[model samples]
Target: MMQRNVGVVFGGVSPEHEVSIISALQAAAALDRARYRPVPIYIAKDGVWYTGDDRLLDPAAYRDLDRIRREATPVMLDPRSYRTLELVAAGGRRFARPARWSVDVLLLGLHGGPGENGGLQGLCEAFNVPYTGSGILGSALGMDKVLSKMLCRDQQIPIVDFVAFRESDWGYHEEAWLDRCEQELGYPVVVKPARLGSSIGISRAADRAALDAAIEEALRYDEKVVVERAVTALREINCSVLGDVHEAIPSVLEEPVRSAGQELLSFREKYLRGGGADGGKHARRPAKQPAGAEGMASLDRVIPAPLPPEKTAEIQALGVRIFQLFECSGVARIDFLMDGTTGQVYFNEINTIPGSFSFYLWEPTGVSFTDLTHRLIDLALKQHHDKNGRVRTYDVNLLSERSLQGLKGAKQRAG
Candidate 1:
């Protein structure tokens, strides 16, 4: 079998920058060495791109990003070629020549910002390259909390009532917005940056004061903010959906264990305190667990979340529906909020490019990390081919002199 170069792209100018790095590195490490060659395409916090040898694979090497930037060869995507990367400094040296690296497909590990929110996906589409995960519309919808909830609500999918506002909207009518939330959603509500993930700018507000503060904090991260009625007896159940709209399946559910007195899953709890976090190396681990970190997989979670068969089936079915509704390709993790007291589930948010690719959830279902990546790459290639098979462009020369004779301002435009 011929080996394919898989560009594992990650890291971006978002609060989840470090988290994205961890996710990408974990993915690169998991790719089947014999079938695929992983190419490190690291997007720096400053928006520069770089690609290098296996040295970029080491997690510890990221501690000094400045050093990595200096050592790595800067590169950028070639818009003219399909799945090709051109070295930024290709011909800078007198004796050196320009070079391009061709990739079979892109395995996106990006979690937040432009990388995950349709920016990179749109670029890939323009370049005519095969890339994993959702396309432009799906990626955009998945990233926006307000839009996703609205879509779910429109489709009769249960979702907690939420009030969305922009920074400008809140600027002059802060009190009105506060009064609206207090009246409609009640006292306790969860405030989050509409387009961010990894719980970076998320907070649970129990009163008007906290709600006000939470909104302000969230606004610092994003222009738009969403405040949802908080679930008092919240149980976060995440289901991973694999493949595209045509044929997709959900993995076994996972219930992440939250610490006592923790109203929401803190960034520390989700990544730092877990057995697999970079900083949690010395932190105590849950009994019966093996050693080593695995990005989100390192977090302590109960696989096959202790739910009844019917409940599991319902959530899994919902996951697949949402995946298809959003026209998502490759893999995505759809998170849900279940009222432990009422046994009701509500659509929370979807991670189009979930951390660790949510492979741990699939592991229990007989899918290994390598297998998950293989399926994603295969799906990407198939989607690309299917898309190209359609009629995309017209062969008519609409801009020719003969055709432009009747057009107004044609000479001005041409000049």
Candidate 2:
């Protein structure tokens, strides 16, 4: 049996570049060699694509961007050929041409911006390639924090009250808008860019002065910004969901314990210090059994959580529901914020392509990363088959012999 060629694309012009590389390399290393051949495709910050042996499985090598570019062959998605990604190279002495490589599936590891926010998905659609993760609509919806929250509210998924405003609107009536935010959400609000991740442009404001500064900071990242009431004394719980829109399975919940003084998990805290001393890069572990009931014990968490069984079930069911609501396929990590005292969970956000692909969460459930990757590849192929089965074009010549005599008479009369 021939192994399917899987193109795992990662690294991009997003702030999450380093994290994406880590996630992609992990996936590439864990892919079952017997069932699939993992091809490393790197997208540089300059927007150039590359593929080759040198680009394989090592996060540290990416630090020297220029070196990687020189070593790897430039590649691009071939819009003309379905399920094919071409490698463009300078012509040899006798022939002035380029080379190409056809891939079976695209496993996207790029996070944020064009990668996670539908740009790449749109390209995949145009190229008729089966890529893992969400479709265009789901990717777009999931990336836009404001829109996703709106959808969640309509679907009765628990979400915090938020006010979304455009920069143009803020420019026109800054005072009026600020007044509305204060009146509606009050102080100590969380301000964030409408469509970014990794806590890039997220801030917590305890007062009007801070709120003003936070909004200014968020505007640098996006045109739209969302201001929401901060969950004081909150516990952040994350759950990974697998499968497609129709049916999904939830991983055990993880409680990201932050420092006592930290109001929110900043980018520095999440990727820098490693969620704290007991929960950094090497210190981190995956979730385990009894399902969501145990919380995330091994990985600096309580596993299944210390919450009641009913609460655990509610969070798990909501996780699956949110996955379907966003029309997400493959795998995604949906984060929730629970009031420490009340134990009420609110939909926080969804990571379409979570870091490390959330394999650690699945490991506890007896699913290895290799098996998880295979499942994603299988799902992608199944979706491709289902799409191909649909009739996309019809054999009709509408312009062949249209009678214009009657239409001309009608037009003349109208004139």
By summed lDDT, which 10 consecutive residues of candidate 2 come out lowest?
A: 289-298
Error of 2 at 332 (Å): 0.6
lDDT per residue for candidate 2 within 250-327, as digits (tens), equals 998777767578888766656556343244433433222111111122134445456777887888899999999899
User: Total clashing residue pairs per candidate?
Assistant: 1, 11
Candidate 1 residue lDDT tens string, 1-415: 9998898898888878888887778777778889999887889999988777777776676878898777777775665665454434432322222356677788888889899999999988888888988999999999999999999888999999999999999998999999999998996899999999889889999998999999999999999999999987999999999988889999999998888998888887878774343434332222222334355766667888999999999999999999998889889999999999999999999999998788778877998877888899999888889989999888867688776776658856887
Q: Which candidate wins on TM-score?
A: 1
lDDT of 2: 0.79
lDDT of each: 0.84, 0.79
Task: In angstroms, give how far residue 93 of model 1 lies from its true place.
Answer: 11
Q: What does candidate 1 score on TM?
A: 0.91
Q: Each model's TM-score, in the order given?
A: 0.91, 0.89
